[model samples]
Target: MLISVIIPCYNSEKTIAEVVSLVIEEIGKMKGYESEIILVNDFSSDNTFDVIRDLCDKYSSVKGIDLTRNFGQHNVLMTALHYTKGDIIVGMDDDLQTHPSQIPILVRKLNEGYDLVYGKYPKKKQSFFRNLGSKFNDFTVRKLLKKPKGLVASSFWAARKLVRDEVIKCKNYNVHLQGLFLRTTKRICNVDIEHRERKVGKSGYTLRKLLRLWASCINFSIVPLRLSMLVGFIFASLGIISSLIIVIRKLVFNNIYLGWSSIMAALFLFFGVVLMVLGLIGEYIGRIFLCINNQPQFVIREMINVEEE
Candidate 1:
């Protein structure tokens, strides 16, 4: 079984080189399965590409993929998955937080017949709000996608090559990797592993970005959409009931009075609800347009100094 260790890099210069070295040193102990380390530089404005190139020159099994621009961590991982030629593939971030030492644990779990083995953290050492928000996202994902109730970290996981292929074939291009795992594979297990705070540099995921991810997770659910339709129906019903009350008040009870403020307020509230529904519809439409475009998830503008043996 060939093992491909795929790490996606985006300006991870501070700690990236150490991660590469650690994976190379640790994976060298495993026998029979040839190992390949694929580092994809996501157009790092820093010296990320240069570091990858240097590593490639130093190690025969090390390879580098240079994307044209930053296509996000998930997109680059998928791109590497497309190019992976391994019996079993392991994926992780270039950040040191997802330790390379745990790769063997995940791979061993995969070998025990599980299609997917994720490395859940012992305790995430993120800021309070980040941790809280991430937990909320995970909660919604579990409720909506019916994914396993595992403490899933977006950091490390291993899967059989077939699982990789199935996930890649998914049509949804928003590219939530863990969700794709749930969507494609039935045999999934998460093992508790070491989780370290970032040794250097701030996290790429900000509060806004986490919330956006939360939105995507919820957006993918039928329940939110069903709820939207339910709310719309309620709103429509309310509008009808309100109009009836106004007419009855004026014609039968003579209690209707002209108050421009109330009328304008109702109009604004109704229109606001309409606009919100439209916004949700627009999000789905935008995703559809992106798929129709069928653009490459990550464009490798150039590969640098690649050599085997």
Candidate 2:
């Protein structure tokens, strides 16, 4: 079996070489499987492409794909999927947090009749904010994507070639890989893996980027829009009921008072609900516009050790 391991790199110049070497050594230990490493540079501002290019030149099995610009981690992975030619595809971050040695565990699960296997960390090695963000992400995935209970989505995972092909078939600009994974297969499992601290710089995901990723889920599911509609309906119903009560009190008992504070509170609450519903609808429309325009997922600027098929 040909095993293709894809690593999405940003400004990971410090750890790229060592990470590649470790992946090679780990895959080397598993005999009877020809290993190939595909390092995709997401237009890192550092010399990450140079390091990957050098590695590609040194090792025939190592390939380098230099993206035109930073398309985020998931988009980089999407582009890499088009080039993978293995029976099984393994994806992990450029950072060494996901140790290469843990890959075989995912592979073992995949071999036992699972289409996809995620490497779940017992204790994720991340900052408090990052962990919080991850929890929020998981929650959103469960609510919006209807993901199975207890299914953990991690960057380090193995998918059969069939899953990879289905994923690559997706052409929309806003790509949520976890959503796609859950939509594609129910035969998924997770293996516990040790998450190590980063050997290099911190994560490329800033607070803004993390929120952007979360917001992009609007393209994948309409649950957000539906929830917004439900909220609007509930608020509108409450408003009508309150207005009727006020009118009845004024007519029958003459006890209704047009208090400025109450009026202001009602205005603020209803306006907030309206603005929220508009924003959610706007997000869906915006994603549709981008998709209709055919936005290129990721532009490739250069490639090394990539054989033209």
* Top lDDT model: 2
- Put down candidate 2 lDDT per residue, 80-194, tens digits, no spaces: 8889999999999988999998987888889999999999998988888788888888888889888888888989999999999899999998888888888899999988988
TM-score computed on alpha carbons, candidate 1: 0.88
| lDDT value, residue 8 of candidate 1 | 91
Compared with the true structure, all predictions reach lDDT values of 0.80, 0.89
Evaluated against the true structure, the overall lDDT of model 1 is 0.80
Task: Predict model 2's lDDT versus the native.
Answer: 0.89
Off by over 4 Å in 2: none
Error of 1 at 108 (Å): 2.4
